[model samples]
Target chain A: MDQRLNAKDFEDALPCDAPDSGPLRWAPPEAPLAMQKQVLETRTSWADLALVGRLFLSRRKA
Target chain B: MHSHLSPDRPTRLCRLLALSFSLIAAITASLLMAEAAARDGFGALDGARAALIFLTTAWLAWGASLALIGAPGLQRRRAQPDLRMPQPRTVILIPICNEDPLTTFARIAAIDASVAEAGVTADIAVLSDTRDEAAARRERFAFARLLRETGGEGRIFYRRRTQNVGRKAGNIEDFFRRSGSAYDLAVILDADSLMSGEAIRTMIARMQEDPKLGLLQTLPRIIGARSLFGRALQFAAGFHGPVFSRGLARMQGATGPFWGHNAIVRVRAFAGSCGLPELSGKPPFGGHILSHDYVEAALLARGGWKVEVDPSIAGSYEEGPDNVLSFARRDRRWCQGNLQHSRLLLAPGLASWSRFVFLQNIAAYVVSTLWAAFLVASFVATVTAPPPNYFPEAHQLYPVFPNTSTREITMLVFGVVGLLIIPKLTILTGAIASNRVQGFGGVIRATSSVLAEIVLTTLLAPLMLLYHSRAVLQVLSGQDGGWPANQRGEGLLGLADGWRSGRWIVLVGATALTTVYWIAPDLLIWLLPVGLPMLAAPFLIAWTSRPLTHALFRVPEEIASPPVVATYHEVCARWEMTWKNSPAEPSAGMAVEHHVPA
Candidate 1:
């Protein structure tokens, strides 16, 4: 309920003026957004079903 | 300047008064119950039962007394006026075992984004002690994807230990030994932990304001609970937990609770004092301390460093186990950890309060076994004892009627119930009066949620008693609960799985019920409350685990989740796509050095 802790206040308080020199530095992905979305959808469904199925079957077996 | 207790005598007096009230209530209730039992012609066993109940209820009363004393504090939002001081660099350590990397990294991303938005000088380290091959692969991919999504390559670092020596405690020590010098503070977090940047900054600033403050823990609200059990817990935590927490803080004085995660600690203090030495024994009783948090807090307190849990600090969040079985599993692990404290009670150089706190934690689990024993004793008394005699023997010509304990017994029950329910009602009344019930969907919804939580927990208590009793027994029998990754998120628990987990409870419940019925039908009513629930354990576990049933016990956290919760969800949603598209095969190590980040 603190007034200073609202979402917009949180978003606008970015603190990244320091020079970036860390192991996380990497080249941007070349994959297009459309292709990425398509791959992501297929993968998401497959992964979701896989996890759900595994958990469900395992519990049932127990 | 940093005395743990107050210099003012009145404050100390208040503390003593609260402590005395708890003691008196427990003593008085126990005596009354014992008196009632004695009148029924049941003797020593009943007396022992009454004594154990006294110890248990006394502990509960102590907690209730603290909550009552601290209830007013909840209404007056403890303000932390922006101190506008230079913030210390913090290393947010997210320790992971074999958990879903997608979910873990999503939480990290959320925390990282919050920190970035707040412009706080904090770095996140995804420290994994995960030994599973598949989980490690997913972890690597997830880390790389997280870096890509947030462009936080250098800001977020990932490391997986090959030899998990001491489990989570060791994993953290590895980080402190390697890179602890770089950061002034370390904010430890669990895999499911998501804390706001503002909250982290506040913690760091508060630490800066007080040089002797070694650790500051936040009361994290349970978010993302999508099951009936989880929601009930979530609701209770949001509504009832804080008042009790405030009371505990008051009782704790300077030596407060350290729940391991969603907390910040001075790196120097933690490194100097909290290097946990394994107990001289084997599994369950020895090796690595499973409940390292309490000991760590005690160590800090012993070193004259203040450890505190500030309930007023918001934006800290974590997920609860979604099902009763999962809850029991986690409790089993905690049971081993807490029971291990029995050995530490006599641990040299611990402050008197620290020793007492250890006993308190131990009692939390031990009380379950005590309750089971009390029930058994009552059953025995009912079965073995002769029926009450309305007429006296030939000593008197007139029949002298026996005294009924109905009134005394009723009063004793009411007293115990009042101790449990008063604090909750106080919190509700305070919230409604102050118009702060809006966050909980107004008074009606809030009251309904509270009622639902009470009902849910009442049904679950007997099952928990069975679980805790078994856990305590397992630990006593030298069985160790190895560090297991908590099962988070919404998932269905099949009836077969529920039965597998709860069959013992069912067996115990059935035995208790049949024994009571065959022996004394009058006592059947009393046993039914506990017994029926135990018999219904499987169904409760399976039914409450379903996401659809969550609506029945909806909490404020779910109804109006904090920004951090929403942020976590959003980040996870975005990452879900990336995780799906991520190559199963490790991409030549993702261009990272295997060693710890410099």
Candidate 2:
């Protein structure tokens, strides 16, 4: 019979309430296209604008 | 002809001699510049200009060195004797991120068919990192249709990661963790990548021949370039790129290049040595190494494995950005990633060559800023120089201007141009001599194409300089250019679009030229080359974005489309009909977003 290791029996397994390493890895967060556009329009800093203003200025929408 | 298993003593001597010659040329230029500076009373600005001249000269010399090393290898072809041993199990991994599924999977199918035709048993895995729900649905449907059409039920697999951790690198790592143990070799491909049956077999056989080889990268030629910018790049890659690659191969030796895709890796070696650990702190400097390919190669080399780039292998192909905006957009991500390698410069256990390669990668971006600074310093020197001192107080015997005479300056300029142009000419000459110019439409047409490439690149250099300078500035300011989906196969950029994308470039160019003119009109002659193209940047971009006249820059690939490219087109044609008839509803259990883990 194949034995299954329960959460309590495993060396590193966690309980249901225990916290895990946040996301396991850092991925560039994804958002909807609208949100991405909004962020590009608003969150982009002045330094960034001065450097690559063309990309931001060419945005089709606000 | 000759065995190139490893660069022999004479080849090594040739590399050293080439380096020495480059140094001598650079030193001669620097000495002349220094003499002129000394005559000008050698101020801080003059000193800065001198430094810039030295760095620029050395950089050009490196290219010259590569040309010297590559010239001899031009006609030398590595013999790949047929392997009678049983072929190894290989898995082709295609990682897609929001690409057109119909085309992407269609390419995969074509590659699969090629592999099958070669009698090479290989499993195909389409790893999806796509985030959009609609795109994911389309990918699944397209993939299902692919399996059915190709009869690749068990051989081909599609798995979309719920969380695309660490972007593409993470996606590959995830696959490795789950089921990588079953395969001996993993051939990685980008969505746009295609390889012919012969190229595939050669790569696998080469790896089999050298058990110490951990990774083998191919020099993928640019194909499917439609727009004028694309065609120019395609021409350069098909022509100049190979000679340059040969030199690069000789230089890299056991430590080699991995260009992320169209390369094969030893599965176990990659699984063990390339488990990337995130850098401490945030990005633009840290976090997941965005330029993972180079670092992975370095890691493999560090683990006592050979990573080599075989430039002689043909038929590997990929697409390039079609226009300036698209090119700049792609460059933004790469610039950030390469700059991020600064943190790993002194990381423990890296080979010395690996560290130097990292520095070279960093310099690839940093040199733009230096060039920009040099230009600024030159402007300052021009504007601030004291009027020509024909008489040096009462001590001078004859009237002499502190600044370099027009003739001397002209000579210096010509010297720099020689450094830049001579290598390219040598490569062209070598190509003709080696009977390799036939593919590029014979000697006459190839010569014309090379001249056109030079002209086009000269006009495009300043724009690239500005783009790279700005990118370096952004990276320094801690701005992370998050991974963006590559925009491919676009046609000519509209005038308005080009203007919008290149407005800042024109603005800066115009402003700089006006400033120089206002301060010192005589220097305008010196600045025209940099200024005029920049002022007309938007227009120039719009012009180059369109089709070239009469296939003026037509590369051999465009002149005679390869059979694989034709096959790809045929596959796409069939796909158009299949897509029209297939039902539109999302298949059951195919909701990509729903599979996301909490």
Candidate 3:
């Protein structure tokens, strides 16, 4: 959840030594920690698990 | 200066030979034990027991083999550190999550001062993934104070992410993508990590001279332990950590481990190779990788780069959980992380050794469950075994049915028990041989510490086994252990809390002992060592967590802290004093400025 930042959120981030002009130019743009976001490439697939699942389903049909 | 293939051939050959020996010996021992069981017509229960024995035995022997390979002496580094070289563009990155802001920032201030004192240069960055607004407010003020005290305006940086994407690993990756290309190298530190300037200088020099070295991991000695549990953990790590690491280093060749902190990594290489892809599954086996350090190292190795560990690099330190509950909590996360590697056992394009390392990581936790299963199987086997032929040969004069398997079974049990001793003995021998025992209070103290450690671990092993067993079952059942912030500087567990957490364990211990006594009185004696401790779980937990003011589990660090550590302690004290005396809370209004001690 992206927190709604406000005046109180930055309430006491007052700089002790440096000038307070910068709006805490702290971070670069946000980057997602998700699996690499290439739509087709980022599928979380485990080949072995998939194989076992197939075998289980096949057995059930029989 | 660092040539990868020219020198490591002998090390590789030795590793291969030892691993082969481990595998063959494990198989042989298991087969012999299985045959012994089948001597009197093996049942399905016997088969299951045999399998469990094999797994546990393999796990034990493999561990002992590492101690065999790792000489107790410091591992020699290939790249001769050239301190004359200009300091590279590097940033010491400390990624924190809801950590105690005052102490964590104090470490940074001390480290910054130490770096200046060494006449070296490196920037420090604190990447905060703290979610709570109140904690974030505390963190920002803490950073402001650190900057003012260190006069590190342009050099020091602080950032907090509102949307915490990937936890620590993601936080680090975010740093690299944002500012990593600006630096040639980066030193990764946990919130509790504190490294001296000299150590920083050495790592940088070694990294600069070697073009192919991707990461260099330092052995972060545990410091600042107060409770008996904390000190015992510290002593064990201080004594056994290096020898095992040295052994691990020799076998690793080009591919080494990344313990997530107190290590230097080539910025570009890590940026390129370690953009970790989240796993496909929902949790436990998927989403973000929990043990990202191991995977990162493997990825670096797969990318044809050298990753290494240099245990001789001292002055790097971190603190641990002070009590049993905290330790178990931290351990549960690690347990889940390792077990999740089952999905990656056959991941493509990995170094065979890397995959094997993954297996060993998984086995480290799974072996506990195997031990639990073995005990259950043993009980069932013993109970179901044909009743002793009381009337064999028309009422034998003595009711002794001539126990035949006693010697064989004892020898097998003895062999299994003896394997656990070999590694400890080997490490001690190496420590004594290399005259490295002095750092751990010389011969007498070190020996006693070892004995104390053995007792501590023996008493705690069954309790941990129960925890590990639960952790494994939970993970298998799709329970995800979210990345919880480490509970540092807090470890006192009251009797009630201990009982609340461990009542099931005590019940299990009592039930097992009672059942065994009624059915097979002889086996009751064999189970006493493990069973008794579980029965006293709450008491042991409470007692070990109490603060100790003794000289029992002292490491060299406790004898006299390093200059950096001393400085950190001073800074932490001042910060705490300032916080206590502050007239008003930050929310209230303007506050008095802190005056740091010179």
Candidate number achieving the greatest TM-score relative to the actual structure: 3
Q: Between candidates 1 and 3, which one is better according to lDDT?
A: 3
Which of candidates 2 and 3 is the stronger one according to DockQ? 3
lDDT (Cα, tens digit) per residue for candidate 2, span B217-256: 9999987776678778888887888878888878777787
As a whole number from 0 to 100, the lDDT of residue B353 in candidate 3 is: 80
TM-score for each of the candidates = 0.86, 0.85, 0.88
lDDT digits (tens) for residues B31-120 of candidate 3:
766776665568888888877887888788777777777765535655457665556888899999877777789899999999999878
Give each prediction's root-mean-square deviation over alpha carbons: 14.8, 13.4, 5.4
Restricted to chain B, the TM-score per model reads 0.93, 0.93, 0.93
Model 2 interface CAPRI class: incorrect
Model 1, which residues run further than 4 Å from truth? A1-62, B1-11, B40-42, B73-78, B81-86, B386-395, B549-556, B585-598
Index of the highest-lDDT prediction:
3
Recovered native contacts, candidate 2: 0.00
Please report, as a residue range, the 10-residue window in candidate 2 chain B with the lowest summed lDDT.
Answer: B589-598
Q: What is the lDDT of candidate 2?
A: 0.77
